[model samples]
Target: MSSLNIATRALTTNMAALQVIGHNIANVNTEGYSRQTVQLQNAGYQSTGGGYFGKGVEIATVDRAYNAHLTREARITASTAAGDAARLERLEQLEALFPMGDKGLGSALNDMLNAWADLSASPSNSTARSVVISRADAFAARLRDTAGQIDLLRNSTQQQVGEHVDAINRLATELAGVNRSIIETAGGSHVPNDLFDQRDKLLADLSQYAQISVVPGEGGSANVFLGGSQPLVLGTQTGKLAVQRDPLDTSRINVMFTQGALATPLDANTLGSGALAGTLRFLNDDLSAIQNQVGRIALATSSLINQQHQLGVDLAGNMGGNFFVPTGPAQGLPAPTNASAATAAATVSNPQALIASDYELRVEATGFSVRRLSDGTTTALATLPAEIDGLSFSIGAGPAAVGDSFRIRPYEGAARNLQVAIAAPSSLAVASPVLVTPGTGNSAGMSVESLYARAPSANLTDPVTLTFNADGTFSATGLGPGNPPPDNPGPPASYNYTPGQPLQFNGWSLTLRGTPTAGDSFAIGAAPSSAIAQNAGNANGMLALRSLATFEGTALSDGYVSLFSDVGSRVQNAQFSAAFSSNVATTAEQARANVAGVNLDEEAARLLQFQQAYQASAKFLQIAQSTFDSLLQTVGR
Candidate 1:
């Protein structure tokens, strides 16, 4: 009876082991299936005079070849790699917008300058004026189009963020359900290997949506957290991610985690590794940089051109009103939660000094201060009306408030807002408003080389005169002594005549070349019809703008070059990071696979070994039955 009982136990235990081996072989290609094996232990021993005799083998719990650390590592690398790759993909799209050669912004700028140069050669030529208008219109159209494309990209990114949030909520809910099932199925007595594999696979999938941390819970349950240990799934309950408009910039979308009635916003900078984090990073960092860069160029170029154009007379002999529609002196955006009706506005005080960054203006109990958002640097403000970098900030409709705050993005939409206010060829401002008049009583040759108007002035509106003395000296005054006062030999108020030298005063300057004899006089004020038709001074000034170092002390075209090259370098770096991170993710997965992944050869060998054991157990049962029958026969005899 003892022999038969031992054979029965051995047969049942070995058959169970064989079944586990077959299971392993069957699931060799399963994604998250860990290699499993049946554990064995000796059955209860029978006490006898010769010591203890074993009752045969008993099956222990089945164990899986899984390592928690390896799975975690694989999850982390996968999350990070997904982020890097997604950011790189979007960066490539932005890079295409900058291009090179004739299709680029640089080409557009060059064409604009060339059009002005053509107008300078023939200031009254209708065709030349039309070309200038066409060029300006084309530049404005191109800028508006580029700005539109950038906004579209941002819209697309925000939509993706919404999708990711939805997916994250779904994953968290599913993981919570899986946690419940796992806890119920694995009731301390038995280890649910398939459930564990399913849970691990869910974790890996969740990590791609947002970075997550997993904590082991009672009864084989996993508690998951997202964006810094905020419980996404705790026991049987789950949380979800939601999206919202940024408090300051409504155009930007932000992520939030919600559970029950509690909602926590995820900081963009600290969202950690995930596809969603990468997408948000692109939206905040790369997208804003491109918008600022492009808009800065538009604002600086257009505003400066308008200023210069205003100093000139158009083909119709009218004062130029905005060659390109002026941008800003703009109202700053108040925060959503501002305490008062106080308002602020910003204007281009100096385009050359403008930094490509947004600013935050906040009012404390004592006073108000502004900060550059890009690097968290403070810019001083003397009072409600102050200047920072190149922007003039002033209060609009404010009375009082302790925590009143505003967002100032002076150049944010400047490109999209670019327009040509002057539509006709007759409106091209290609001539200086003031004319240079040589006296008829001149004794020698004297010529006006060039003229530049630096600012508006009453003296410029009135006649200003330069009169040559017999002693190689000249007197300059807005008074009629030189305007009608072309006389003076005194050295006290007169300047010594120098050829090819500029005579500057009252916000305007002029270069004079050649010998100046006694009684030679020049006057400047209202432009004659011939002057408006013949003079190309303002057109030359417009052409010279191409080389002006007004964009962060770099030429306007150079600013575009800087932006293009900078983006190119960023694209290259992003590509390398994407490739390296993907490789890292692959290597990490391979490392995890080495331990928990199914090996068909190993499983086959185990199958054979277990088959042999099963055969031996069967034989033992047969032998036990034969011996018992023999003993019964003897007893019968």
Candidate 2:
């Protein structure tokens, strides 16, 4: 090679190097921009007489400083962090509805119970009765409000899912366009560093919404897959994503990917990491469970209270009515798309045994299969009134077809439907129906103690007589309108009347204390008409409700507390996970940036090195030009 050619090659290589250095410094602060470096190689040598003449350096290619492994790790971590953050935000909103301490649902339940206790102290006190009613209404209102808020949150989450799907579709389309551009620009020999940076930025943005896997294709194009398998982008062809309602559960939202003629639905379990996955999980898992739990408390409270209230007599001598409106059963009609006209209905068989869950009934060739949504427990269909977990299932009028199915949400609206049934204070039942009296001319000091009418409707028009005998045994004569009618009618049934022992007969039990002398007797009969009808001081029935085991062998108050604890624990766990994921994502991002990101100091030093090289290359060109000029002058002379 000649001096002029060598100098020209050197000058061109340095100029290209300087330009690459300038580009790097200019994009130092650009997000997702990888540092660019100019590769240099020795130019080809020419054969000479003695040896091959050396040639100057030439520019090979401009390469991007990007670590694929670190970049992938960062993207994955970012996806996890985004999902955790989204879930944590929703959990915080839900947790806010259940404020702890004295202002929460537990406190509301306790207040209602305490009002009941106060009413028991003065069963006929108008103010006490009104207070009980007011507290009950307040409690129901609270549950309704909480349930309403939860539903609103669920709807909001669904809307957010739709919006994120739209964004994913938009980004996928843009990425495909970039892929086409990169292929057209760098298909021959070199990597399009700027286009590669643009594609990487798009990938990072896409990862926030969904877990994506990118496969490098020919001609610098990439094929992106969602959730590892569903194709999103294939070599300049973009797939669209959409949010649709789940067929089985109308309230649930599902993400669908459409590529060509095929569409696939993605659910929470299959979607490994993304904001969309987190929102779906919260809506389907956490929010639904919380709503069901709240509804469970409402149902249990109403059922138990109504049961106990029915067993008591009001001040008007009338049977007590339901204290609170019981929750109605959930029925599922045939789906609109079902070809067969099959329907199913559910009723609460035993409220005490109810589990907080939804159920699905599917008609099979043999019969029907019922599965609980919460735990996926299945049972074969039985008779019309088949009972399971406090629910009674009944088939509709006609036989169901093989493909017919229905979803039964037993507690879906329980909380919202809870209300006080009794509006009047006089309707409160707080008295017993039977009374006991000591016989006349008794000297044993035995008195009428506690009495409970186990069978209030039993014929008790005439009083039973219990006489203490000298042999320490008692004889009971059936005196309650018995004309060969009473079951226990006999010739003086005899029994030992031990002190402090309950004397039980004729569906009534009485306890007597102290010593009983001979001829000492007691009478047990229906309470006097005036006392039964007008007495306003009896509170025994109301007091008994305090210790009543209402739900799942637990008191109503304790059940509410348990539900509150569960929500709080879940909120705490979600927050912790969000924080941990955020920390990990930050670390991964830092590691990636260390490799691909540009530093001002480093770029400045490169700028100086390139500038010096350019100056040297220019000086060599100047020397070559001067040598040529001198040689030309000598030739002319």
**Per-model TM against the reference:** 0.88, 0.85
Please estimate how well model 2 matches the true structure, expressed as its whole-model Cα lDDT: 0.78
**lDDT by residue (tens digit), candidate 1, 1-637:** 9899998988888889888888888888888889888999988899999998988888889998899889999999999999898899899999988878888888887788789877777888999888888888888888898899999999999999898888888887887888888888764766888888888988998888778889998678889988887888898888888999887786678788887889889887667878899999999888898888898889988888888889888767887789888885767788878888988888998887888888888887667788988889986555777888888887778474778889888877899989988888888778886667888887668777877665566666568777877777888767432223333445546876678766666656678889888889988876776668887878877876777787667897677898788789888998998899899999999999999988888888888888898898889899999999999999999
Per-candidate local distance difference test? 0.83, 0.78
Please provide, for model 2 over 1-637, each residue's C-alpha lDDT reduced to its tens digit, 9 standing for 90 to 100.
2888888888888888878888888887899999988999989888889999878888888999999999999999999999888888998899888876677777777777778666545656789888888988888888898889988998898999888888899999999999989878864677888888999999999999888899997676778988658888998888888777877777677788787788888756767787977888888889988888888888877776676567567878887788898666687846656667767888876767888888888887777788889999999864455898888887776877787888888788888888899998888876556676787799857765556543334563357787877765677776443223322323444676677665656655567788878888887766765765333223443343445565567766677767877788888998898999999999999999999988889888878897888888888888999989999999999
Top TM-score hit: 1
RMSD of model 1 against the true structure: 4.4
Candidate 1 worst ten-residue window by lDDT: 480-489
The candidate that achieves the highest lDDT relative to the unseen native structure? 1
